[model samples]
Target chain A: MATTALSSPAASGAAAAPEGAMVGGDRKWALRWAYFFLCLFAAFALMPPLYMLITGLKKSSEISAATNPWWVYHPTLGNFVELLTSRAFQIFFLNSSIVAVLVVAITMAISIPAAFALSRMKFWGSGILATGVFLTYLIPETLLFIPLFKMFATFRDWTGIELINRWYVLLLLYPTLTVPFATWIMIGYFASIPRELDEAALIDGASWTQTLTKIFVPVALPGIIAATIFAFTVAWAQFLYPLAFTTSEDQLVLSVGIATTLIRADVFNWGQIMAGALLGAAPPLIIYAFLMDYYIAGLTAGATKG
Target chain B: MANIAVRDRAAFATTSRPRGSAREFFRQKSTVAFFFTLPLILLIAILVIYPAFYSVYLAMLSKRMDRFVGWSNFTFLFTRETFWMVVKQSCIFAITAVIFKAIIGFIVAHLVHAIPNEGQRKWRGMLLVPWVIPPALSTLAWLWLFDPSYSAFNYVIVALGGDPIPWTGHALWARFSVILVNIWIGAPFFMIMYLAALKSVPAELYEVAAIDGATWLQKLWYITLPMMRNIIAITTLFSLIVTFANFDIVRILTAGGPIDQTHVFATWAFKLGIEGGDIPLGASISLFMVPILTVAAIFILRDINKRGERI
Candidate 1:
């Protein structure tokens, strides 16, 4: 849900334990029940993605109706290998990569300065504009895709240049998706910096641009990373936009492309679907695995602080 | 020397005129700020503002991207059985999913909050895996699990000496499956947010309640819920908007199928606008989503502005 973005990064310190705390009596029982529930939910949380890994490694012959779908016996990399080698799969991966990276870059470029202006440099209507930005972030592709589809159609009719069915056209649309949240996250981050930091620079004869580049950007590197991660994930995971905008085989991004290209005519290639899904999810998953704290921080930052 | 001093004072006033005068509309460094935000404002204008009004305009036109048909597309949709079905399905889908997500998130956050802080991070991280993964990719995995013939769930059911239910085969089951996936993907977020909120609920209150022999349910209802009321409202309202607009899980899982039983405004709009080639019809369907979202946004921004007051 787009409300997913409205959350500001929650502070890790919220869970800080009391010094020299002791557990006693019936509370131990409560702790045990807590762990029990925790394990239950963790299993529920983990099962599907874990199943994807198991299913991805299995061969088509092994994924039959009779076989145990839970266990991957005699696992093969055949699905992964086939998908990785396929040109269509590669194009999907490539388009997704291109779009995600470009979106992140553009998102950061626009968001950092904009966040600086909103958070650091006060201006007329900045308060209203900041709220407007957050409001824009809430506008999901569901509402936009129908209109976007028409807009693109109208565009082609007027300009004689096709906007749909092209990979690069996504570059134009993705900034809208990423920039708002990225700016929101950066605003939270920039606001956390003491006003003195910038004011001191101003007194030292530094310009606003110099203060931002020389100070805020470097100081808020973690926030930048957080925003970048969020943007990449959004761009990569987005399905409806690509589905509506790009229908052709070569032009499709991974999410829409996999759904359309692989899941054809009821002859479901379960192995390939799982494999492609895993492969497609790999970038964002890997990014989360490494920089999870930043990702979590960026998500909650808006809700908590913004 | 006195005249020169007065002249210097006057010169200083001139230098500070922008800040001192009533006419300093843009304020200090506003020029730099404007340049900084120009790209972002332009992007919102082009992609968001332009498209929004254009879609409304498009919805008025015929499918050929020509002619001013006024409210005919909306009228035409109102006449169709499928449109009403979609509206009903969307309401049921969003309301049910958000309610479940909130309740589940609260319970999980409480459980996570109960345990010692040492092990909480690991559990929180593990619990958040669903929220972290792409909804589209994860839905593929769900589809596999719901594969009627090859379902792992059916495998477990068979192993337990029971019949395998049609997971996505029947309309009822398909609706249930989509909502299940929606909850599975969304609830962890509620957990994370609620957990953060739970953390912010001062421990001293809980300790005092415990000293007074308060029951857990009493503490939750009287203390926890009240403390978390603002967050609960904002999060729920926000989630409602997102769930109403949800496309990936439904599209991936059911594609608004089984006789259009699961068609939310999103997938239904996509089907009509893009796939069905009735772009005007699709725009009309999707535009129906705006009023609810506008209401939600107003509530969120107002709440956030109030929070800004406290800061």
Candidate 2:
């Protein structure tokens, strides 16, 4: 995935040819057959998401006993309509949107500058700071949540400033996940910028601040978008932070919200669960669909740069 | 005129102090540089660096910090009944899944690369959809596919005149189920990486091999494998770190169920720390993950540094 960032430019060059390019002889026939099987498996691999869409469109009663489980008999928009209008689902979506947007903003704010400094400055501990930023990538969210949760609990007990079960709590916590990779990515982007431009800005009496803001930021726009999307996806789909810290219904993001709210102990709500699954998946899927090339470039840069 | 000349002389004296010393200071520009980087330094310190050290601190103390027991919790982990099983299961889950994903990904990537250019993009995009979908939602679809009574997998097996296997109930089967899901989620990464590596292999090498009368297998062994060595090594290491640390697939699929026979390190830690309230033990368990992941990180860093020299 990280290599996607590095290889996308090269990949686009290889992929930009016309469809009708020919392969010759019986070998071409075998090649076509091989493609046929691969595409078949690809379709089969794609069935689950398609099934979720099909199941989500079915009503609960029709889903349970429908003779053709693969096909929808009485397809209705009620499930989508209901979930859209439902207060609980709305809260889940709102929380997700807020968290994703805020995390992206915060990540870019911290990482872009940090990346620039690491790339350009001869400051003390620059190497250590750069290494520290990359090493944080290895720390899983699960490892941090327990200690963070305990720390937050202790703070609540002492100062009566409760950080748990609030959407804003993620504002502080998500950086642990987003900033490191985002910083690493921006370092790659900033390193690619010509040093002459910065030197020119300095000669013209621009402060380092003005140089970064006015010069590098505009040139690194694609990197920023890639980092933004990465942060957004992480925040939106994150399961552990929301599950461990924000357990309340209204506070939950889409990932934990659907898992906790839609299903019960004895009986799972297959229809509603699939419905929530599709809805939860849509934002990132839509984003990926549009910006996959840039997303890949961002990830590869972070990976290759690290 | 005398006052103005005196002022000009004072300004000239100030500017003449051999701009060398001050020029040298400003040349590297460490002070100005630090100003641009302060926010990042402060954020990582407060958020990442502090908490990382905090975990180690949490591990040294007993619950509630009432007692300080150095390495007692670490020893206690070995004494616990579920500890060894989790360590074993996590190793099996991560290693097996990574190997299969690498193989499958290589094959699919080679196949995708064989296609005409225009067909390749759409097919590659389709191949990558599994990775694009959120893991939680995709894993739910997997959960339903493994539902005991009415699984899509069981339906396919029965339709083929075979008995239904308990995909997530039995110990070995549950482990296999999780690994299978991991492969499904992870293989596309291998495909993408290998595809990139494949494209980087110059066409001239293959043409030369063909001119020398090399067979398909010879071309793969002699040209393709050697060309992709650096990327393959790095991608495998990357996948190993991610798969080893993976918490979601196991948690969502089994939650270490059917008598807790399926718990990996991350899930075991979660069960102990969050569910059972044993923060120290969980931290200790998580610490065990660091050594392997560190080695993986080093390889990745080496790979990245080598790449930096290239492009």
Candidate 3:
């Protein structure tokens, strides 16, 4: 799939077919102009990332002064240093990391088995349950958080159990956002595996548990990776859940931490905020750069299967 | 072949025997399937289904949390002055963002597709950075870009001898800022989708059209768009649902404040529920959004199923 991308006719024929394809020189010139303009648009689309990098590299004085905001005069790593060394940023990062990792683990724990059952087993309400799982994806977190907040409040009121203002509360809430999609993606993955393998395992005195753990898990690593990345990204990037649930300084994740504390009423710390934003954005961007194929695979899993 | 058939018949008979064999009755594959699926069922039931039903139940009462009010929550929402404004804003947000994202993403993907195949991967990686970052963090960057005191955007406009526009202060400017941020965050997703679709189009077809002397514009109008119809439909509908229900970008950017000019349905619900402590009315207001969202979901599902038929 990746190999055929670069060897298409344009790349191959551009070298060889100059004379043969010149039936209309005007059209060829127009295509050249088209390419030039399209390149500009691509550059326009790329400006934000560049702007982010430039602003992130600029010093606080350079950013604050009424001077050339676009260009970096004195590029310093002080903002980066501050963000890295600050205890607040560290707490937010740690909370985000722990919550995201735990959510990924928990989502897989529930979804893989459910996907296996929905795809392979023909139970009475399996089809209904599968539809139910898909429907859960349509329920936006905004709508869900209100009732969830009320329920947590009630739980606190009744049982003296406080689910709010805790980092662990996010571990519970994030799965509600991620598991449905992961389960759906995994179902597609498990369904695509050849059934004959499972049937063969069934006949060899292998229990379902043994077959799933031994046979399916090893072969389905790519799909599992795709699902895991999706789950991780979802948990890591979530904003409303953390905002609605966690308000304490120590409990905050990166998203709410920046929004709530960084921006005062009349003061907007552009340098520090940009630094924090860039640092907060670094993990997922790095992950995408390294694992883009898996990320795309996970995103288009719905397209591939459903 | 006869020996295999005879053994299959014997195995089939043993498997089909009902309520006779102890191993078959208690240790059937279905029983195993139940064990595998139980965790998922319990989690969904406890976390999703129960809250969903309970939210509906909660939506029937008033702010006092007293006796049932029976449709008054919905009635009160409809009669409120701000509710209709929120509805209009939410619709504008969803439709406008989806359209711009679709247009911009299509154009960018087409440009990316025009690049030499060898360099396409690198260009795609760069273009996909916006999508890779969390929207919350990116929107915070955007919020800082339009900050009242130290706005980079204002500095640019002022440097260019133009009045420093109030990006988030004025009503329309706040709306524009939020939508711009939404477009910035969302367009990358559609670009990736359209890029995949563009690549999937067989080169032979484009070659055939070129041989037929179709212009490049004609080729795109005739070949590319038609081939991408199903994908376009599903993707547009998907964007609609997401943008309509979007909470993070709006919340982080403006929190639907500055005199409540830019409040969408989701943020309004949050304000009502969290600040007002009126859970029932908030749930009812959000429930009002379900019909339109469900219709969009149905169309998306149908389009997805239609695409599924081809495979």
Distance from true location, Cα of A5 in model 1, Å: 45
True contacts kept of 3: 0.54
* TM-scores of all candidate predictions against the true structure: 0.91, 0.90, 0.91
- Separately for all candidates shown, the number of backbone clashes (residues 3 or more apart, or on different chains) is 8, 4, 0
User: To one decimal place, how large is model 1's interface RMSD in Å?
Assistant: 3.0
How would you order the candidates by DockQ, starting with the best?
3, 1, 2
In model 2, which residue pairs have backbone atoms overlapping below 3 Å?
A2-A300, A5-A296, A5-A297, A5-A300
For candidate 2, the per-residue lDDT at A186 reads 85
DockQ of every candidate structure: 0.45, 0.38, 0.49
Model 2, runs deviating above 4 Å: A1-23, B1-28
Against the true structure, whose DockQ is highest? 3
TM-score-best of 2 and 3: 3
Off by over 4 Å in 1: A1-23, B1-28
Return the clash pairs for model 3, or none. Answer: none
Off by over 4 Å in 3: A1-43, B1-26
Chain A of candidate 3: what's the TM-score?
0.90
- For model 3, how does the per-residue alpha-carbon lDDT over B118-220 read when each residue is reduced to its tens digit? 8778877777777888888888777767877667778878888999888898889999999998888888789888888888899999999988999889998
Query: Lowest summed-lDDT stretch of 10 residues in model 2 chain A?
Result: A16-25
Query: Candidate 1 chain A, which ten residues in sequence have the lowest lDDT sum?
Result: A7-16
CAPRI-style quality class for the chain A–B interface of candidate 2: acceptable
